[model samples]
Target chain A: MNLERLGRTAPAVPLLVLGLVCLIFPLLVLLHISLQVRGGYGLGNFIDVFSSGVDRAALGNSLQFALWQAGLCVVLGTPIALALVRLKGRARGVVMSFINVASSFGGPGLAFAFMLLIGTTGVLTTIWSQLFGQAEFPSLGSMIGLNAIMLYVHLPLYLMLSLPSYALLRNEWREAARMSGAGFWRFWRQVGLPTLAPFALGNGLQIFMWSMGAYAIPYVVTTSPASIDLISIEIGRDLESSVFGVERAATLSVILMLLAIAMMWIYRTLQRRGERIL
Target chain B: MSAQTVAPLASTGTTTSNDEADSFLGRWGALILLIGFLGIPLLALLVFSVATAWSGTVLPSGYTAEHWIGALTSSDVLSAVGRSLFLAVAVCVINWILVIPAAYVSVVVEPRIRPWFQALAVVPFALPWIVIAAGMQLTVKEIAPGLFGTVGLLVLTLSGVTFPYLYWAVENSLITNNAKQLSEAARMSGASLPRTLLQVIVPAIRTGVMSGSLLTAASVFGEFPITMTLIGGGYETLPLWTLRMFSGRVPGAGAELAAVSFATFALLFAVSLLITRIDTATKPADPVRPPARIS
Candidate 1:
């Protein structure tokens, strides 16, 4: 395989043009919507999105929820992924498949099922009452309930992303640590923790983007007017509620895209630093 | 779930006996974590699907097939399943076409451009499917107005989302195996590049290609946002159909949801098993990493 041969095969112009167009179109549309005003061109929409307290709150809440959910997912998912890649035998296969399937699980239907489980008189609450001898159902409607479900929804992806790196840790390293008389805490801190950090950060950032941008999980699980109103939900609500201001939704879409891009850049930089350390 | 929670001892102690115990703990630790984390939720889902009244209890009061029966009869479930299957197959075919040529260049044609092509393939992988859904919707609105709500739209959207998986699988196959040896073996016998690619390289990576396709199918089949936002009211895939079933009315809706989940899981599980077989078969028998030299 050679570069000269690749150049000779075709001009490469068409491919380059197509790639650039595909990459740029969505961002351009977002910018266009963000800058446009009532009847003409201006920065009013952008100003409105940023200046308005509600819009700012929604953006803040979205980030907060995304961070919490993604964090929880990474914490929970890493061990499961570790088990899948490192463990063996019949039982392992069954567990692996179950996690794989559950990772793909959820839709609006899942959101609704969770709603039933965690909501008032839901299965979980009912069980809680029976255990505690409570007369009435309790509320689980704060950020914790919403974020927990969101974490569960995104756990599989985080796990999948983190599994390879976790698997990359050879068994010999563990054996070496044991032979050296390193205790559980020492082995984890000196060998395991350092190895997994970069992976966790890279995977965490991706999970953060997912949790932040996801519309369905939050839409289904949370309080109306969404106590932790994220940007995606706002965009959807605007699209559904507004008569002709589809542009507003478009404007928010731009903001989200920019945030995602920025977050990814930061994530990659962190990964690069991690690579250097290793 | 297993009560076993033995942990591997860190490699510090001198005794062979201790090392043996550590090995046992490592294996058992993995097993316990697998059951506790993954097994429990899945078991919960299965138990709930069968229980006539799962509410108000840690365990289901009783078991029944009413949910399975309800799912079978439900028009929503049937149509959703049908649509999901169709979309997944369509995505598999479309991605396979784009990937074969791209992978060909990566492996057989030009090696220097390989890194760039591989990077381009993975670029989309880094982006969430939701971004693609949003981008696809916007791109469709501007490019081809009529294609927006059709099956063609769904197919194309899923293809873009899944292209990387297919590319990585096919490319990894090319890089890992004795491609140059096979191609040189063919070339010395007077086969053209295209012939060598189609006959030798294609067959060589067939396992990788199929595994990639299966992975793509599982992802696209389970995908929800693309169906919701892009396909809109016209197309009703399994996820969308399940969503409709739960969102709307009909008796025993919970049971139907459970049934669809089971069906979806079974279908994906079968696909994954086939992939696992192909992957293990394609790899070299020796456990060591293959030589780095690409053809």
Candidate 2:
């Protein structure tokens, strides 16, 4: 009877349908597969994932990797973001463009680049060996090295995300602090760090989730599946090995999803607090 | 007069010195960190690409263009590049087609139910890629075994994986640009809903659509695990091909790895440059007002 109501309903219905078919349906399918272990419906796969030593190790490795990656990103990215917001003109533009490129510079391409730069017989490694009289440079394939690569990929992202908080730190507040006889360190302690704490925490959690879910970089850098036992890598290995196969992979996927959702919830809460502080 | 100005002049001098020191630390210190952390590895990749032999030395012993020539001329490399490009373009087109209308409907037509739709859209980002891949694989196997290991399935998986990028970008653009007002104005002039959307809303948010498309393209170009696990049977995208090269399958193909990295860098650089150019060109013309809540 009403043209306006009809017009609105027409577009809304199709969008709702598409979202259901594409997004909601697949995730439901994933849940279904996770439930269907050994041609039956049960929580056996999840129990197996938690009870097994190797699977539990993979989960632990992923958590540790995520925590270290987030910590390192915050340590390295904050000063860079603070410095960036203080800049003006062409310099700011150039540095920002570089950060943009770096933030988007992950995936297999970045893995290859790092491999060429620091792998065994790599340029930097070769130089270190020759100069120091060592046979080989420290391997970039270890947990430490993997964390370093993850840091390089994630630092720019954290910096970019945290720039708004830095920008919100008005120069007037610093001037007022100085006028009140506060020194640099005191001002930073009293004003700067407190204001940025929520933002830093939020950014750290975002980076944590990102590193937890990363698949390509670790896949390319490590020589073997067991070399790095991240959940993502474990999922891939399970799918490939045919020992645990799709059901185990699906079970692991559900676990990863639950962890991510939990982390995302924390991140959102911190972000809201940060916004309120600003 | 000189004696009177001395007091203020001394204050100004001290302030200038302090300002200079601060600028130095901010500029040069930040630059050095960025170069050390981000730039040096890329520079090394470039050098390695041209090296005649770089083993056990800081620098390449000699340089040649042979690797570049061979990498470019190889049919396998070319086909891999072609497939990646084709996939990226197809993904971009599909995303735009799907996202534009959906963003429009949610943001303008039925803002009441936007959150429900938005939540669904963001599910891909919230869930791990492995889960999505595993789900799609099992579902596809059951539904259409014929489509398994086909490029078409890969495209579908990618569209689902990468749809959130475009959806959020376009949705933000629509909201910020006040698309609903423009649509209402068009409709008041006797234009139908579809006509108003096509002419008014689409033109208003063209830059956002382009940005989202380019970002989606860049992302799909670098995608590895999905392409490898799902479609590695018959399809080899650039990233997968690069992986094969690094696995020591191709003899003397170290330079090819370097070349692929550079090419990926080049593509990412171009996409970023275009995004910046669009941002700058559009920024001054449209001073953003805080958008009114739609519903």
Candidate 3:
């Protein structure tokens, strides 16, 4: 097979170098810039990130938003996933295609869709106003509002991500439970939920990381500072503020990167556990 | 409700009349929930795009095709679409050049380092786009100021961000198809290494390559934050154009926004169709369950 010749001829070294330069070097630069203060390297910028009340609030808001978004996505997506697995023929194909399309609805396209449906002067908002004989509907403001919008974007994604795991559920297990006189609820509560917990948790954490790092949707939806403030927006704001804000932006980015790393680590662990169970 | 008490009666039939009713109700209920939640907004967007005016109404007050025509015909919009298409295609090509060799070598020649190489490839997914853009912006400004605000820097940034999709696709294809055996076979038949890779390995994984490129292109087309932050006003992408419509940069641009939204959806739909086609065509005769840990 000429394995040695293949090894000698492969561009392994160049590929490795390209990967490092493309993926790792920018992160290293980010870290380096994050440490810089007053034209010299120091932890002062990170200290500023930790000490500032505004920065702390932004971080808190981001975590809260991500938690709620991930929670809602799981709550709403799991049942749909279960039902989807039960579907057959044309219905399954149509629903699956819809999910695929919806999962791709992120960033600006999704924000625009929601705006058309629920924003001020939005279609649904207008419909609600007419139904109640009111002039205007209440604005979708605050962290809860942001969470709702995020759920719309992320639910299908979670559903698609979790579908494969649900497919792993054996029908024989259900039959066995039913034969043993276990009711449907008991069968699911005792066996189904426990078996699928890792996949659900893993998908939930992935959603958490997704919303945590997301910038575009929040950027488009939340126009006022009085609304929810996320860390992604805060970083963008800082970076655009002034030359000095670059360091502060870097500091916040480093923090955001750390949080993402922590969440991803947990997600990977849960995914591994889920795989082992399967 | 008390299944234990009714166990003897229920044991005679798994699907009793009551159970059939429940299943029917449950299925319809789920369908309604799915459609109402995900389908309605998209439907609204489509309606709005074609409507002449949607202000102060539950539905658009009037219908018109002007916005669709405007979005399709406008020079700025057309240019933005072109730019996005060009950038997406360029990113796909760059990623292909970068990832194909890396994936091929890792899979066929250096199996031991596959894990480490995969970890490196996935780094972009972990880091937030804003953070990467901020850092890349700073780095480019400092090092290659000439390339700043040019398509050249954007090509670089997009390549980094979108590389993982193609890499994973190619790697998965290589592993699942057992490309090494084919490469080895080709080598045994007196084919050189390059010949083996180009003629044997690449063809074997063509589906993966096509799907990966399409996925990469879709992501790049929709990307906004990096384009907005790093190369703002340098080159307007389609997403940026949509953003401008929403921001009221152009007066009475609601119809245009709707058109762009629909267009984006169409693009997304087409990509999904292609992906589905590739998936169905390449599906193994004997299905291989994907390892859970791979994702």
Candidate 4:
């Protein structure tokens, strides 16, 4: 397959163009515009990220929302991952398929499905009002409902990512802990959590990244111009509806890309540590 | 939900007569949770879609099939569905032309450039769609402002956004199946480059590429942010259309939304089933990394 000997160019040219358009060129645009602040090329755009109240709040809110979602997924998904590890054969298949279907619901579609359960005058709201006579049910489009949707869509992913760590937890360790007169609480507290902590942290960090970058759900749910609370929504607003314009959005995108890279590095380090401990 | 509570109870099971029940609960807790999560919402959506009117009640006033019929027959639903289908198919076809050759060149024609292509392939995993969309919009708008909102641009951009899936999938297949060796073998007998790729290496990795394309189609089918950002105007896809009806506070939109959800979910379920069936029979153990993050 020596194309050079055959007097032909490698078909890498189109690949290069695709790369330029998709990654290289776009990043260049972001870099170029991010430098085009009101006065000229300086840290003005970067400063605005912190000095401007709305921009600062968007960054902070993205952090808060991502942290809460990732933290909850780890807490709620660990047992499911453990149970998945214990179950075997056809039963495992059935359960895994259920997880698969749920995971496939992904972002916006899952948000739509959950709307019936949590929207204003949603079925669950109606049922809750009838049962408790409260006559009020906060909709899923709110901050509370955002958490619920993130958890629902992400918990299954957590289970999948964490299952391998469960496999690292050998049954013989449990047997040894039991033979030493340790109760399950003592075993898990002293042995299990310590062993699985790094992987859980790693998995949680990945979810945090996903949640922080999430735009479609927040976009679909919010009817307003732009967000003062979320990075993705604010980026969108800057591009579409806000007077802040595409330059501001470009700056935010650059910042987000750097943050994502930093988070990924930390996750890789934690995953390495987890594997080593195992 | 803590390991403390669930574990201690299971510990007591080893010495107690209620061991059977405790162990059953311990082993099946996830299944029970999933049933509650996946099952309840689906049933609720189904009932609500078919229900005549369900405001402020645990149950609908009455059940009917009119909404489902309406959704299937409605021009809006049909057009949206048709548009999404066209986009997904267009994405699949475009990636086949773009990715397969690039993968072939990297794996067989020239191995030295593999690193660059590999690096670019993994970019989307860390890159947010909005970030990419912004950059892409700037790039496309700068290049050809008229093409900014066209379906052609969407097909290209989506092919970029979901590029990693097809790239990695086919790349893995080529590497594993030893396409370099196979291509060299074909060339030794005087086969042309096209002939070798079309006859030898392509057949070997056809299943891998096809399934990758199907999975790509699945992603495009549900894609929102890029489509919304790039072509939010002069277009109507299922996600956009459904969002419009819901967000506009369009009266009587519930039953209609449910009908669309039910239909969309059913189609999605079949595609997933097909993907799983193909993957199990063909795909090797996946790389240690998880699949693409939820889009």
DockQ of each: 0.29, 0.42, 0.47, 0.43
With a 3 Å backbone cut-off (N, CA, C), the pairs that clash in candidate 3 are: none
Highest TM-score, which number? 3
Model 4: chain B TM-score relative to the native chain B: 0.87
Q: Which model, 1 or 3, shows the larger TM-score?
A: 3
* Displacement of the residue A116 alpha carbon in candidate 1, Å: 5.2
Per-residue lDDT of B198 in model 1: 85
Using DockQ, give the best candidate's number.
3
For model 2, residues B138-223, the per-residue Cα lDDT tens digits are: 67777888987898888877876777777777887898798888888898899987788788888998888877777788778777
- Per-residue lDDT of candidate 1, residues A138-228 (tens digit): 2333577666555555666676566656766777786666556665566778888888888788888877877767755554444454356
Per-prediction TM-score to the true structure, in the order listed: 0.83, 0.90, 0.92, 0.88
For candidate 2, what's the RMSD?
A: 5.0
Provide the global lDDT of candidate 3 against the true structure. Answer: 0.75
Task: Order the numbered candidates by lDDT, best leading.
Answer: 3, 4, 2, 1
Interface RMSD of 3: 4.5
Clashes of 3: 0
TM-score-wise, the better of 1 and 2 is: 2
TM-score (0 to 1) of chain B, per candidate? 0.81, 0.85, 0.88, 0.87
Tens digits of per-residue lDDT, candidate 3, A1-278, equal 47775566367666566567666776778788889878688999888887988888888988888899788878777877888888886556666666677665665666667777777778777788778765543344478667766776678778878887888888878666766767767777898898899989988887787788777778777776567778888888776665555777778888878877887788889878877877
Sorted on TM-score, best first, the list reads 3, 2, 4, 1
lDDT of each: 0.64, 0.74, 0.75, 0.75
**iRMSD for every model:** 8.3, 7.4, 4.5, 4.9
